[model samples]
Target chain A: MKLEMRDQPGQLVAALQPISAVGGNIIAVIHQRETPAATETLDVQIVLELPEGRLSRLLELLREQGVSVVRIDEERLLYECTLIMIGHLMHTDLSDTVDRIDMTGSAEVTELSLVMPAISSPSSARITIRSTTREEMKKAIRILRSVAEQKDLLIIEPLEGA
Target chain B: MRIAILGFGSVGRGIARAILAKNLDITVTGLADSRSGIIDPAGIDLEAALSRKDNGGPCGSLDVTPADVVAKADYDVLVEVTPTNVDDGEPALGHIRGALRRGKHVVTSNKGPIALAYPELRDLAATNGVFLRYEATVCGAIPLIHAMKEGLAGNTISRLYGVFNGTCNYILTRMAEDGLTYEQALAEARELGYAEADPTYDVEGIDAGIKLVILANTVLDMRTTLDDVERTGITLLTPEALRLAEDQDCTIRLIGEIVPEAGVLRVSPRIIAKSHPLVVEGTLNAVTVETDLAGDLTFIGKGAGSVETASAVIGDLLYIRDRHVQGS
Candidate 1:
C-alpha cells in the first residue's frame, strides 16, 4: 500500500498500525519524506501480504485514522540495496542525484536519511534504492556512484546482500 | 448457475428479461412476488411465468409460497428485489438473513435492509463465505457502487459527494428551467411516475439520505445508519430562492456528501454553480470521488428505470460469477 500521509509525528505509525492490525506481514516499507509531491505529505510505499480481499479494509482503516493512501502497488519489488553517501550532500544538490536514478523508471531511491554531525562539517545520507530486478539495481548503483563522483562526494559502497 | 429471485416486481422482471436477453448462463429456479410464489428446482420457465404474471395471474401454479422459495429452493444465489421497508427492513431483511445463513450468495436492490443492517449482513456474508451485493440500492444504472468498490480500487477517497436522487433532481430541474413551483413540478413528476402519491420519501430527502447511509457504510467502511445522515429536503425551495442562486450562476441540487476526515455525512439542498458536475439536468445521478492518486473522477448515469436498475443487478451477478470462476 502506497500512502500519502501528513508529515507529522505518529503519521507513519498510524499508517502501519492498521496493516499490523489486519494481520499483514510487513515485508518492506519505503518511506521517502523528501519526495512528497507539492504537499508536504510523506510518501509511504509499503509491501505486505495479507489475506486476499483485505486491502480495502486496510485502506478504510487508514482513512479512518486520517491517513490518505495514494496508491496500492500490488507488484512486488525483487531487488533492494542501501547505500551511504558521505560528503557535502546538500551543496551537491541531492534531489538531482535522486531524480536521475528515479527517472530510469525501473529503480528508485525510495528511502533517504540525512544527518549533519556539526555545523560546518560534511553531511552524510543513507539511501535505500529498489528495482524490479538485480540488474536494474546494479544500474542504479552505477548511476549513484557516477553522480557521487561528479559531485566530489565519497561513496561508502553498499555492503554485499545488505 | 441456479438462482432464486425473491421479488417479481418490475425490477425483478427486468432482471429476468436481461438474463434471457443477454443469454447469461444462469437459471432461475424460483421466483416470488408479493401475492404469489413459483418454485421449480429444474429451472423455472421464465417466459411462461412472465407471461402468466403479465396476464394478471399468479406468477406460479397454486401450490408454492415465498417461504418455500426461502427454505426449499435448491439454488446457489438469492436475488432479493423486495419492497424497501426502512423502519425495520423486515421481510427483505428476513429473506436476506435466511439466504446468507443458508450459505447462499445474496444480491439485493433494496436500500432499507442495507441502510439498516449493512455491517451485520457483511459480517454474516464473511462468516458464511458468501457474497452480498447491492449495487442497485443507491443510484440505479449509474454503476456507482462497482466504481467505488472495484474500478477505483487503490485510491484513498478523501471526500465523496453527489446528486443521488433523480426524483428530487428532476423536480428541482423542472422548477428552475420552466419556472414552475415546487408543487407544480412535483405533480409533473408524479404524472411521470417519478414521485409517489405520498412523495414524502422523495421530497423530504429520506430516499437520498438512506442511499447516503448505504454508501458511507459500504464504500467508506463507516458503520452509519439513515438516522446518522443530517437530511434536509427540497420542499422548502422557492423559485425566488432559485432565482437568487441563478443570479450568482448557481443552481439548487440535492447533494449527499461524506467528509471522512471530518467524520460527517449529510444530505441537503445546496446551491452549486451550473458548471459543477453535480449540476446535471433532469433525473440523472452524478457523483464525484476525490482521491489522492486519481484526483477527482465524476460519474453520471440514469438513476432509475426497470432496465437501468436491472443493469446494475445483473452487473453484480456477473461480477460474482467471474470472481468464483477465477477463484476455482
Candidate 2:
C-alpha cells in the first residue's frame, strides 16, 4: 500500500500506527524523503500482510489518519499446502484433478512433481496448492480429497499448517 | 491387592514377570488362559504357570475356565488383558461387566470393550463404586490416559493426535529409511513380530481408528465409534511417495487425531517433518496433546511390547491400589 501524507514531523509514524491497529504486519516501509520538494506531501510505500477482509477496514483507518491512499497491490494467494498423491495418476486424468482446484479462483495448484515407476505400477505425485486464505486452502484440500477418492488415489496431507 | 488375571498371553505373562521382578505387593489370586485357569485364595504360583505356558501347554487346569475366574475368584481387581475382539468385544466384555458388578476394580489392555462399550462400563463402574482403567489400550506405555484424566485434569484439550500404531509406524519407518516398498517393509515387520500374519487390521488403519475411538469416548468426552473415523492407511504408500516426502526433509507417519470440538476423528498416513517430535523411530509411539492452559505436551515412548504394555496395566492397577483398594 502506498500512501501520501503531510510532510510533517509525525506523519510517517501516524500512517504506520494505523497498519498495526488494523492487525496488519508491516514487512517493509519505503519512506521516500527524496521526493520533489515542490509538494508538501510525503509518499510512503508499505508492504504488509493483513488477515482476510481487513483491507477495507485498514484503508478506512488510514484515511482517518489523514493519509490518502495512492495505490494498493494485493497478493491474494498467500496460503499454501503441499500433499502427496499416489495412484495411477496419468490414467486418472490428473489434469482434471488439478483443474478442480484452479477453477475455484481462490485457489490453484501451484506446483507438481510426479514419478511413474513402471507402466503398470501406481504413480506418485507431489502437489503444492496456493490459496487466498486458510479457509480456501481447506476447501481446496476437500476438493482434492474428493477427486482422489473418485480416482482411488491415496492423498497424504501434511500434519500441521495444512 | 489380590487380583484375578484373564487371558494368560504375552501381556499376562509380562505382568506376571513384572510382578515377580518387583515386590509391588500385587497378589495374583486367579489366572486363566483360553483352555485353563488356576484359582487360589493364596497368591498363585506365577513362575510355575509361566514355565508351563512357555512349554506350549495351558497355564493351568482345564477344569477351571476364565468364566470361573471372573465369577468365583476372591480378588479386588480384575486384570482383563485378553485379545481384543473388535466385533463385539466378546468374553472380555462379559468379564469386565462381571468384575464391575462384583464391585471390583478393572484394568485392561483390550481395546475392544473400551472402544465399543466404554459408556455403559463406565456407568457400571460408577454405580458399583469401582474404578475402570485401560491405560494400555492406547499408545502402550505413554501413560496418556492417566495424564489426560489426572495430570491435566482442569485444562481443556482442543486436539489430540500422534502416531498411535506401532506396526504402521515400523512399516513407514522402514519404507522411508531404506526406500523399501510397502510389501517389503510389511514383510520385514511381520518377520520382526511387529505385525501379525494378517496385517489388515494394523495396515488398514482400523487399529489406529479403534484407539481414536477409545480416546474420544473415554477421555475427550466425545461419542464416537470406529465408523466415525475418516481413515486412510499405509498400504498404498510407495517408496516414491516416501521419497517425495523425504526430499522435503519430511517423513510419513500414521497419525491418529481427534478434535473434540470439531467432532473430528481420523487416522491417516500424514506427511510430517522429520524433526517433528511425533516422528519417532522404529516401533516407538508419540502423542501431542494441545491443551488450553499448559500449551502442547508431547509424549514419546514404546508403543508396543509385552513389558511396555504391562507398564500401562500395572500403572492402572497401582493407581487403583493406592486410592481405592483397602491395603497394599
Candidate 3:
C-alpha cells in the first residue's frame, strides 16, 4: 500500500503503527525523502501481509491516523491446506477434480504432485489448495471430499482444527 | 467386597489373575464362561479356575450357565467383561440389566451394553441405587471415563478426540516407519497378534467409530450411535500417500473425534504432525479433551492388552468399593 501523509517527523511512525495494530506484518517499507519539497505531502510505500478480512479494518485505521491511501494491491488467497488423495488418479478424471475446486472462485488448486506406480495399481497425489479465507478452505475440502467419494478415492486431511 | 465375573476371555482371566496376585480384599463368588459357570457363596478358587481355563476346558461345570450366575450369585458387584455385540448389545445387555435390577453395582469392560443403551441403563442404575461404571470400554488403561466423571466433573468438555484403535495405529506406525505397504503392514500385524485374521472390524474404522459413539453418548451428553459417525478407513491408503504426508513432517493415523457443539463424530485417517501429543506410536492410544475451565488435557497409554485392560477394570472396581461398597 502507498500512503500520502504530511511531511512531519512522527507521520511515518503513525502510518506504521496501524499495520501491527491490525495484526499485519510489514514486510518492507520503501520511503524516499528526496521527493520535491514543493508539496507538504510525503509518499511512503509499504509491503505488508495482513490476515484475511483485516484489510478493511487496516484502511479504516489508516484513515483515522490522518493518512491518505493512494493505492492498494491485495493478495486474496492467504490460507493454504495440503491433503493426499489415493486412488486410480488418472482413470478417475483428475483434471476434473482440480477443476471443481477452481470453479469455487474463492479457492483454487495451486500445486499438485502425482505418483502413478503401475498400470493396474492405485496411484497417489498430494494436492495443495489456497483459499481466500479459512471458511472457503473448508468449503473447498468439502467439495473435494464429495468428489473423492464419487471416484472411490481416499482423502487424508490435516488433523489440526478440522 | 464380593463380585461375580462373567466371561472367561482374556479380560476376565486378567482380572482374576490380578485379584489372586494382590490382596485387594475382594472376593469373587461367581464365575462363568460361555459354556459353563460356577457359583459359591464363599469365594471361588480363582487359581483353580485359571488352570482349568488354560487346559482347554470350561472354567466350571457345563450345566451351570451365565444367566444363573447373574441371577443367583452372591455378590455386591457384577463384573461384565463379555465381548461386545454392537447390533443389539445383547447377552451383556441382559446381564447388566439383571445386575442393575437386583440393586447390585455393575462394572463392565464391554462396549456393547454401554454404547447401545447408556441412558436407559444409567436411569435404571440410579433408580435402583447402584453405580454403573465402565472404565475399560474405550481406552484400555487411560481411565478417561473416570477422569471426565470424577476428577474433571465441573468442567464443560467441548471437544474430545484421539487414536482409539490400536490395530489401525500399529498399521499406520509400521507403514510410516518401515515404508511397508498397507497389506504388508497389516499382515505383519496379524502375525504379531496385533490384528485379527478377519481384520475388518479394526481396519475398517468401525472399532474407532464405536468407541467414539461410546464416548459421545456416555460423557459428552450427546445422543449418538455407530451409524451417526462419519467413517473412513486406511485400507485404501497407499504407501505413496504416507510418503506424501512424510515429506511435510506429518504422518497419518486413524483419529476419532467428537465435537459436541457441532454434532460431529468422525473417524478417519488424518495427517498429524509428528510433534503433536496425539501422535502416539505403535499400539498406544492418545486422547485430548478440551474443556472450558481446565483448558486441554491429553492422555496417552497402552490402549489394548490383557493386563492393561484389567487395570482399568480394577480401577473401577476399587472406586466402587471405596465409595459405595459397605465393607472391604
Candidate 4:
C-alpha cells in the first residue's frame, strides 16, 4: 500500500519510526521535489509492506504524532476538520488571521479569505478553516478568535441558522 | 488486454515506457508508424524501437502502417499519436473514426479532433459500446478533465479559467522577469523546446481556446466552440505594459476562461491580482474552478511536453482496460 506524508524537516524520519517500531518494510518513496504542500512540507508517497495485525496500531501511533498523514486505507480513522472564526478581518489583518489559526499545533489552514471590498470594508470578517479533526480544529479556531478579540475585532462562533 | 500503438513518436514511446514500468495488466501487441507496424503480442522491444528513433532510420518503424496494422490485426486497444493539424485537424479524426468503426477502444493524445468534435466522437464511441478517452487533449498531466468529471462531480460549476497554455505562460514569464521583448521571449521559448518554431496556434491563443472548449464540456457540461470563445494572445504585450501591470502587483498571462451563467457562456481574459493562486510562475499551469459545493479548487502541474502528455493518455488506457477486464 501507499501513503502520502507531509514533509517536515524530521517528518520523513519520524514517520518511518512508527512503522519500524511496528515492523514495516519501506519499498519506494516518490518525493515531488518542486511541489510541496502548503505547510512548508513536501509530499512523500511511500510504498510499504506491513504486518497485517500491526497495521492498525502503526496508524494509531503515527496519528499520535503531529504528522499530516493524507491517505491510510487499511484500518484507520478518516480524519475531518472544520473551524469558524469571527473578527474584523477587513480592518485588522488578513495574513495575521491566517497565521494565528495556523499557529495552532494541531490543524493547518487549508482555505481562507476575507470578504471585504478593496476600498470600503466592514469591521468584521468571517473565516472558515479546515483541518484534520473537529476537536483540534475547534481549539485552533478558539485561538484565532482570541487573537481577533485582542485586535478589537468581533468573533462569530458557528451557529445553526434558520 | 492487447493494445497496439501507432506513430511511435514522443507520445507512443512514453506510453510504452510507462506500461513497462508499471507492469500493469496490459500487453503491447504491436507498434506502427508511417514505415511499418510491428506486431509483438508478447511485448515488442520498446528499448530497441526507441533506440531506432534516436538513431533515425525512420521516425517510427515498428513493422507496418497504421491502416494495415488495424485492418489485419486483432487488437482491442488502438492508441493514435499522430501530428495535430491546426487548420484541417485531419489524421486524428481519420484514425479515431476508423478505429471506432472497427469496434476497437481508442485513446488519443491528439487535441485537434477531440476539441472540435467531442460530442460527435463521444456519441460514436457510445453507439459502438466502446471507450474513447483523451485525457491528454487538455493540460498534459494535470488531470483537469477527470478532476472535473469525477473529483468534483457533485458541484455545479459556474466558472472555469486557468493558465492553459504553457508556451504562452513561458513567454510571459520570461517577458516579465527578464524584461525581454516579445520577440526575444518568443525566440527563447522556441530555443528552449517550449514553443514550436512556427508557434501560430499557441501564440494566437487558438490552442488554449480549444482546450477551454473541452474543459467547458467536461466541467460545466456546456458545449462551446473555438469560435464562440473570445481569445487574446500575449503577442501584443510590451515591456512597458507588463511593467505597469507588475507595478499593480499583477502578472499578465494568456488565460482561457469559460463562465456559464444562466445558460450563457463567456470566455476571455482579465488581469488578476498577483497573489491569486492561479498566478503561477514559469511553465507551470494552474486552474481555478468555482463550484457551488466545493467552493474553489485549484490544480497545478506540468501542462505540456510529450512525456507528461503521454502519462495522461496512458492513465486513460489503464482506466479503460480496468473497466473492460472487470466487466468481462
Candidate 5:
C-alpha cells in the first residue's frame, strides 16, 4: 500500500501501528524523505501481508490516526460488493453508471442484471462489483451513490459484510 | 507454474525442452496441436509427448482443439506458437484472446495475431489484468522488444531501422557477395534452408512488414497495420543495384525504417553505408532504435531458430513467472 502522510514526527510510527494491530505482517517500507512527483506530502510505500478481511479495519484505523493512503496494490484488495440501483437507470444513462465503476482500476462490475417492469417505468439493476479490498468497494459504492444523487435516483447498496 | 503450449511445432518443442533442461518449476499442464490436445493437472511428460508425436501419433485427439486446452487447462500462461496466418491471424488470435479473457497471461511467437489485433488484444489483456508478451514475434532471439520496452524504458524512442527478416537478409547477402540475380539468390536461400519452399512472404517484404508493424505498435506506441507499412520487396533490386551500393561504400539491405516525427513507416531495399549498424551480413537480424536518453541502440542476433526462438519463449515465460511471483 502507498500512503501519504504529513511529514511530522511519529507519523510513520503511527502508520505502522494499525497494520500490526490488524494482524498484518510488514514485508518492506519505502519511506523516501523527498517529496514524490506532484505531491506535497511524504510518500510511504508499504509491502505487507494481511489476513483475508482485515484490510477495511486497517484503513479505518489509519484514517482515525490521520494517515492518508495514496494507493494500494490491486493484490491487497479482496472483497466483493453487489449494488442495486433503483429508478430511471436508462433515462439517466446506465453507461455512465457502469463506466464510473469500470474506470476505477481498483474495482470492476463483473456482473450486471437489469429488470424493467414496463417501458415507462424505471429500471432496477443488480451490479456485482469485485475489488481488491473492502475500502475500494466502498469507494465505488460512494461513486454509485453520487451518480444516483445527481440523476435523482435511489441506490440500494449491499448490506454490511454481505 | 502451470503452462499450456498451444502449438506442438519446433518452437513448442524447444520451450518444452528448455523448461526441462533448465529445471524451472514450470509444468506443461496442457499440450495441443492443430488437430488435438492433452491435459494433465500434474504435468505432461515432455519426453513421452515428443516420442509419441514423432511416431506419428496425434499427441492427444482430434476432438480436443487448442482452444479447448486454453479454456480448460489448469495453467497460468498460454504459449502460442502456431503457424502464422497473415491474412487474418485467425486460430492464433482467437487462442490468445480466449486466454487473456480467462485471466491467463499470453506469450506468443505468432506474428500475425499481434500484427493485426494488437490494440484490441492489448486492451483486453490490460482489462483482464494479465500480460501479453511477444518477444519471439520479431527478431526471434535478439530480445529487441524487451530491450526497447523495458531495458530502455526511460528513453523516448525517435526512430528505428533494421534488417528484420533473416531469409530476406540471406538472399540479399548472397546477391551482394556472389553477384547473383534474384532467382539465383532465392535458390541459394532455399538450398541453405534459410527460406521456405514458397518464399513470397519473405522475399516480397510481407514478413518484414508484419514485424515492422508489431514493432511500431509495441515499442513506438504507434497503431499501424501490415497495410499501413509502405512496403517494397527486395525482389525488385538487381545485382547492379548491389554493385552500385558497394561502389559507394554502402550495401543494400532489406531495411524496415520508421521515423515517427515524419510519420514514416516503410520496408524496402535501401542502400546504407557499410559502416552502419544495420549492415550485418548473412542470416542475422539487427534493429537500431534511436532514443533520446540512451542514444543509438543496436541489437543483433539470430532472428529465427528452433532453440534460439525458444530462448525468447523461455525469457517471456520467466518474465510472466517473476511478475506473477512479485504480484502475488
Candidate 6:
C-alpha cells in the first residue's frame, strides 16, 4: 500500500510507528528532502508491505492518531486547489494562521505567496492548498476565517452568483 | 454515504480507483453495467473487481447484473459513466434522470446531456432536491465548474473564451510545424491517442462547441443555443495558411470565444498573438474568463485525463457529502 502523507515535522515518524506496530514492512519511502519550489509541503508517498487483512485497521489507526493522510491505497490521487485571501494576510501572524489550517490534517497549505502593499496597508495572498476532499477546503477556509477575525482582517471569498 | 458507478468504462474504473485510493468515508454501494448494477452496500473488494475486469468479464460479472444492481440498491451518489451519443446523451441521460428521480445525487462526465438539456435537467435536480455536478464534461480535471459555481458566483460574467479542443489544436500545431497535411496531422494525433479514431467530434469543433454552450449559459447567465454561435473547425485551414500564421508569430487554435458584444453573444475561433498567455500554454487547454468585478482570470491545466477527471468526481462527491451533513 502507498500513502501520501503531508509534509510536516514528525508526520513521517507518526505515520511509521502505526504501520510498524502492525508488523508492516517498509518497502520504500519517497520523501524528497528538498521542499518543492511552489508548495511548502512535500508529498511523501510511502510504500508499505503490510499484512493483507490488517490494511484497513492500519488506515483507521493512522486516522485516529491524527496523521495528515492525503491518500492511501495501491495508487494515490492528489488534488490541489488555489484560493486567494485578501485583507491583512500578515498582520494576524501569517505563520500561525497557516499553521491552524494545516492542523486540520486533511489538507496543508502547500504554497503561500503574499503580496503586501506599501505603507503597511492591508495585504492579499494567493494560498495554494492540496487536500483529499472539498470538505477539507471548506474546513481550511473556516480556519482561515477564524484567524482573520482575530487579526481584524476581512476575508473575501470568490463571489457566488445570485 | 454510499456510492455506485454505472458503466465500468474508463471513467467508472478511474473513479472507483480514486475512491478506493483516497479511503474516503463513503462506502462503495454498487456497480452497474449494461446487464445491471451490482449492490454491495457494506463495502466492496476493489482488487477482486479489477481482477474480474482484467479477465474480460462483463462489468457486473463480479457479483450481479446492472438491472438487478440499480433496482436492489440504495445509494447516496450514483455515478453514471455510460457512453454518450452526440444526437442524444442517451443511456447516460436515462441513468442520470433515473438516479435523480430515485433521489440520488448524480455526477457525470457526459457532455451531450448537459449541453443539450441542462436547464430541464437542472430543474429536475432542483425539484428532486439533489445536485447534478458535471465538472468533467467541459475540462477534465480543471475546476472550471467549481470556479463558476462557487469562486466567481458573485460576479456577472460578460464573456468566456478558450482553446477547448485539444485534438484540433494538436493537429493544427503539427500541421503548422511539421508541414503535415490535415489528414497527416490528424493521423499523427490519432496515433498519439490525442484524437479518437472517428475524430469528427474534435475536428468538427462539436466537442468544444458543446462545452462553450455550457460555459456561456452558466458564466454569462445567457441562454445560448448551439445554433446561435458560428462554428469553424480547423479542418478548413490549409498548410499554407498555417505557415502564414507561423510567419506572423501566431498559432491557429480552435478557440471557443464568447463575448457579449453590445446585445449579441459571440463564440468563434481566431488566431491569438504569440505574446498572449494562452498561446504560451501550448498543447494544454487554457480558458480566460472575463467577469464584471474579477476582471480577466485565466485557468490553465491538463484539460483531459481520467485521473484528473476522477479528481473532479471526488470533489463533487465531497461537496454533496458536506451538503448532506449540513442539511441533516
TM-score (chain A only) for the predictions, listed in order: 0.54, 0.81, 0.73, 0.44, 0.53, 0.48
- Per-model interface RMSD values are 28.5, 0.4, 0.7, 16.6, 31.5, 17.7
Q: DockQ (C-alpha) of model 3?
A: 0.80
Candidate 6 lDDT over residue span A1-162, tens digit each:
434455578877887889898988787888765656466555666776665478778888888766656766642214455444545566667888788878888778888766554546556565666665566677777777677667765443321100
Candidate 3 positional error at B95, Å:
0.8
Per-prediction DockQ comes to 0.01, 0.83, 0.80, 0.01, 0.01, 0.01
| Candidate scoring better on lDDT of 2 and 3 | 2
**What shift in Å separates residue B52 of candidate 5 from its native position after superposition?**
2.6
Q: Write the per-residue lDDT of candidate 1 for residues B1-328, one digit (tens) a residue.
A: 7889988887998998888798788889889987788888788989888899899898875677777798889888889998789899988998999989998899999998899999899999999999999999989998888888888888888988888899999999998898797889999999998988999998888998888889888998787887788777777566655654565576678888888877788787765678887789989999888998889999999988889999988888888888762321
Q: Which of the two, 3 or 6, has more DockQ?
A: 3
**Clash pairs of candidate 3?**
none
TM-score: the better of candidates 4 and 5: 5
lDDT of 2 by residue, B1-328 (tens): 9999998888999999999999899999999999999999988999999999999999999999999999999999999999999999998999999999999999999999999999999999999999999999999999999999989999999999999999999999999989999999999999999999999999999999999999999988899889999998888999999999999999999999998999999999999999999999999999999999999999999888899999999999998998989954
Per-residue lDDT tens digits for candidate 4, residues B197-311, read: 8898888788888887777765567787777776556665555445545655665677776668844333233455678887788788898888999998989999877679888
TM-score of 6: 0.63
Give candidate 5's chain B TM-score.
Answer: 0.95
Worst 10 residues of 6 chain B by lDDT: B262-271
Model 4 DockQ (Cα-based): 0.01
Task: List ranges where model 1 is wrong by over 4 Å.
Answer: A1-162, B325-328
Please give the lDDT score at residue B17 for candidate 3: 94
TM-score for all models, in order of appearance: 0.66, 0.93, 0.92, 0.64, 0.65, 0.63
Query: Which ranges of candidate 4 are over 4 A from the true structure?
Result: A1-162, B59-63, B262-269, B326-328
Could you give candidate 5's per-residue lDDT for residues A93-148 as a string of tens digits? 98888899889988888887776657886565666788867777878888887887
RMSD of each: 23.2, 2.5, 3.0, 19.4, 24.3, 24.7
Residue-level lDDT of model 5, residues B1-328, one tens digit each, is 8889988888888887788788788889999987889988888998888888889887786788787898999889899998899999998999899999999999999999999999999999999999999999999999999988889998988888889999989888888899897789899888988889999899888999999889888888888888888777766555655665566476678888888877778887665667887788889999888899999988999999888999998899899898773322
Which residue pairs does candidate 4 place in steric collision? Answer: A86-A155, A86-A156, B36-B63, B36-B64, B37-B63, B37-B64, B38-B62, B38-B63
Clashing pairs in 5: A77-A132, A77-A133, A78-A132, A78-A133
Per-residue error for A1 in candidate 4, Å, reads 66
Across A1-162, the per-residue lDDT of candidate 1 in tens digits comes to 678878889988988999989887898898776664678778888888775567789888999999987777755666777655667778889999999999999899888877665667666566778886677888988898789779976554321332
